[model samples]
Target: MRRLFILLLLVLSCSSKDTLPDITVKDIEGREVKLSDYKGKKTVIYVWSRTCAGHTEDLKKLSRLVNEYPDYRIISYAVAMDIKDVQQSYQQIGIKPNFITLIDPSVKFNDYFPITFLPSTYLFDSKGKLIASYAGLPEHL
Candidate 1:
């Protein structure tokens, strides 16, 4: 019975890590935004830092995805960067993102979703369950 209980605990812990946590984060405008509010839509979160390479191209691709996939919610989460820097990067790229732009100066989201590397992309289903995650830009996007 003890072995079965341990196995069940392990399974539960592992499965819980795959879902988006009900945490609040800040948007570019410094407004409190709840991650849970994005539920009921196919969400794509792109995590990037200011120093990360290929961000410019990735942002451009994300812009295309925003237009191409209207059904999916594309979110650009900038970590360890100031709001001004994030805004500047967008302006420099010459593309206004039609999707959501969030700022994570302290990388609070990492606690829920482990981001081992920069420029990571995560896809979640309408139910807030993780569908797929890519270390770099996914070619399909």
Candidate 2:
């Protein structure tokens, strides 16, 4: 029985990291944005907070990657839950203006992203299927 239980736990954990909910989020401009809209393109969805000092480097690296790959779509979601804090972090970190910013107020991401940590990144293929998910800056960026 114990072995069976362990196997189930392992299976659940391994499989849960792949896909994410196609939840709707509000952009900084108050426009509704859906993850599904980015379908048919390589997309990177970054979830980070304003106060996470460790995320600064990852953000910078991601910004550079986005610039280098014009065909890829990168979206940033601020889990800070406050637009003011998000804006302040943006200015402090020097996030480029072209980056699309989304807000996840009410912390609904906990249901889909398993954000026990501060920063998480999800990568999707051209079909909008999740290719991989990482807790921090992945080595390949």
Per-residue C-alpha lDDT of model 1 across residues 1-141, encoded as one tens digit per residue: 999999999898887467777777788887988887888999999999979988889988887898888989999999988789898999888988877998888787898888988889999999889989898789885
Q: Relative to the true structure, how large is the alpha-carbon lDDT of every model?
A: 0.87, 0.75
Clashes of each: 0, 0
Report each candidate's C-alpha RMSD, comma-separated, in the order given: 3.1, 6.2
Error of 1 at 125 (Å): 0.4
Clashing pairs in 2: none
For candidate 2, the C-alpha RMSD (Å) to the true structure equals 6.2
Tens digit per residue, CA lDDT, model 2, 1-141: 999999999998876345555678788877887756777878887888866657788777777777876787877878857777777777788876466778888667677667766788888888777878888767674
Judge candidate 1 at residue 30 and give its lDDT.
Answer: 79
Model 2 misplacement above 4 A: 1-20
Please estimate how well model 2 matches the true structure, expressed as its whole-model Cα lDDT: 0.75
The superposed Cα distance between candidate 1 and the true structure at residue 67, in angstroms, equals 1.8
What C-alpha lDDT, on a 0 to 100 scale, does residue 84 get in candidate 1? 91
